[model samples]
Target: MKQSLTAMALCLTVWLSIPVAFAGPPHGGNPGRGGGGFFDSTNEYRDAVSLQDLQERRRQREERGFERLKQLKWQTGYTMPQHYRSDRYKVDYNYYQLPRPKHGQQWYKVNNDYLLIDDDNTIIQVH
Candidate 1:
């Protein structure tokens, strides 16, 4: 009975120690002992500034594109540029609270304006 108890105690000790052995070093085992994660250095600040500058440049480029679109004087009788005729620019008239287009006519959204174009790519109207 004593031998059996000794064996059980040894088994329990080994079982408990197994978890501690595999637990690994505390605090992620960082040799430098630095606990701060990700944004923990001066480089992080530089990265943030560069990211903001990139965003600003993107905004400026988009504004320039919109300005270019606005510069085109869309007359009623003139044909619209070919690029604007793509399906991507097409919009539903009812969704924009505009009047339904006549046959062979479709509505297109360019920047903030709505343009109605005919099948021949002529600018029927601009709103």
Candidate 2:
């Protein structure tokens, strides 16, 4: 009976001590001063543009691309249907046996008659 009681008391003591040993200061207390999270660096950027500005830029790009394609078609010597109109035009100067110029802005004539038109459609240039 005494041995059984001693074993029970030992068991009780160990059970009680388990929680005490587990209860230490939290591994790392919150930093004493205010600090942002890992992703909260102040130097990081989060600025955003207004939706209207974004939409306007997209629209301008689409318009410019369409006009450029149309111009390429017209300048490439491709025949456009009677009812068809392209925002872009292309003229082919290869048929005339003319040497290709180094600069694209230099105009070239095609079929002894056609003129290549170069124009700024909608691109914005920054100095």
- Top-scoring candidate (TM-score): 1
Off by over 4 Å in 2: 1-49, 74-127
RMSD of each: 15.3, 22.9
Model 1 lDDT tens row, 2-112: 999999999999999998888744445443555543445655787899999999999999889768867887779988887688999999988899999999999999867
Computed on alpha carbons, the lDDT of every model, listed in order, comes to 0.84, 0.45
Query: What are the per-model numbers of colliding residue pairs?
Result: 0, 16
Q: What TM-score does candidate 2 reach?
A: 0.22
lDDT of 2 at 91: 36
Which whole-number lDDT from 0 to 100 does residue 88 have in model 1? 97
Looking at model 1, the pairs that clash are: none
Candidate 2: C-alpha RMSD after superposition: 22.9
Q: Each prediction's TM-score against the native?
A: 0.46, 0.22
Single out the weakest 10-residue window by summed lDDT for candidate 2. 118-127
Return the top candidate by lDDT. 1
